[model samples]
Target: MSKAYVFTRNGGPEVEALVDRDMPTPGPGELLVAVRAAGVNPVDWKLRKGYTRPGSVPQPFPTVFGSEAAGVVEAIGPGVGGFAIGDEVFGNPVAGGYAEHTLLPVAVTAHKPAGISFADAAVLPVAAATAYDGVRQLGLAPGATLLVTGAGGGVGSAAVQLAQHAGVRVIGVASASKKAFVESLGAVHVEPGGGLADRVRALAPGGIDAVFDLAGGDTLREAALLLADPAALISAGDKQLVAELGGAPVERARTAAVLVAVAGLVVAGALRTHVTGTYPLSAAGEALRAVEDGHALGKTVIEVTV
Candidate 1:
């Protein structure tokens, strides 16, 4: 038997709870993983709270909550290749990751880097991939100035580092407490408030070359207003806003591609994972609460070692 975090109904965090179930066997073209760590994201709670769009739900009842995880390949399904039992791997599986065992497609899984730990490897899928996609969408050139809203969050922090890696100047928007951290990532921090655009303009008078809005509210609107001509804008948070700015929706295929690129970066030592806190599988509720309260500095992960 394997323990998994499953949501039986659509409601708040209270409605979604962890339960023990029989271990699942991988199907054709799939790989069964013994999950070592599971990265928690806002989406998990959003889905539990019924904030997710109807189309995003693949199953009705007893749905799994997580998508990203790192583990050792315990078994490979028929016809699967390029992997073996005991191979260390990390990827976003189709089912819930907040469990001791999970199944994922072979295409989405990748070999873990030798230098990275399981905790670090688990943080790369969603956050790092989203940042990569946003940066790629902008086609940002070297020396170009890029504005990243919500610059202290997971995707935001990742964007700050990835932008700097690409030789782009970054202006990060974050709260007062996160100012130093954002700056450490090589971005000029702007406090979030009414005068945010003014502050950004003060930093770069001619305006920015691209805008990556990870926080979607007034900051996103401000980003749209400040975009340079023929500018690139990408948002991983708001689909409606993305459409309004003529940007495409972030789909599974695109997400997978971005993750693959991020994995390559981890292998090359150009990127690093940042995990703020970790919780045992039994404390999944507390972990979700921490994420909802916005207390974590980086990715909050659940360690399912049992």
Candidate 2:
């Protein structure tokens, strides 16, 4: 039996337990991989608390809690191509990532290069890839002013650096505690909470050209005030609320090619994955809490061994 961190029901952290289960086999166009590392994101816990994306069905109970992982392929599924056993790869998990083994769809999977660690690759599929996609969707020109909400966290942090690297001027909204950290990524760090619009306006006296929000609710509302063109505002957080503000939600290009491109950016040093915490399979709950509490810096990961 393979070890996995699972939740038999939809509830709080208490619902999760570390247990062993039969190994999962790959389905068509999938790869059965020996998981080396798993990325923890806010979505993991949200889904655990029963938050299913619109139009998506809820997964069955006793579900494992992870969406992205990197590892060595052990078996290949039918109708798959361009990969073989023993390929070190990373991608969205077909089952889940918080386990000794999981399945990865070849469509979104990419071979992990030697230069990148499994932990780093694990975080990219979800966080870094989302940031790359949102930035690409905006299609901001060089020197364009973009404001990124929740800049202290994973997607926000990635957006700041990626936008800056693409010659876009970024004003990052985060907590005061992460000012130095955000500034380190070449963004003008501004704290959130009341007066957000004033602070952002003060930084970019002219105005903001676009907003890429990771923090929903009030932050997104305030961010909307900075841009004259509402279409310039997009969020990965709350789609309904963003729509009310005349902005759209992030349209993710969830494909293996996008994964490959972002991974390439990381290897080229144009993008970076800031994994601030690592937990073992046994500490999956704590690893998840780090992201769920809304205080984690960059990304948190679960490192598994053979």
Q: Highest TM-score, which number?
A: 2
Show the lowest summed lDDT stretch of 10 residues, model 2: 53-62
Over the stretch 1-306, how does candidate 1's per-residue lDDT look in tens digits?
Answer: 888888899887667778888888999988999999988888888877777664565666787778789999999999998899999888888788888999978777778877778888888887887787777777778999998888888888888888889999999988888888788777998987887777888999978887788778777877777775523777777768766876544443434455667877877766766688899999988887887776566678898774
Off by over 4 Å in 1: 53-57, 246-260
> How do the predictions measure up, each by TM-score?
0.93, 0.99
Candidate 2 residues lying further than 4 Å off, grouped into runs, are none
CA lDDT of each candidate?
Answer: 0.80, 0.92
Q: Pick the candidate with the highest lDDT.
A: 2
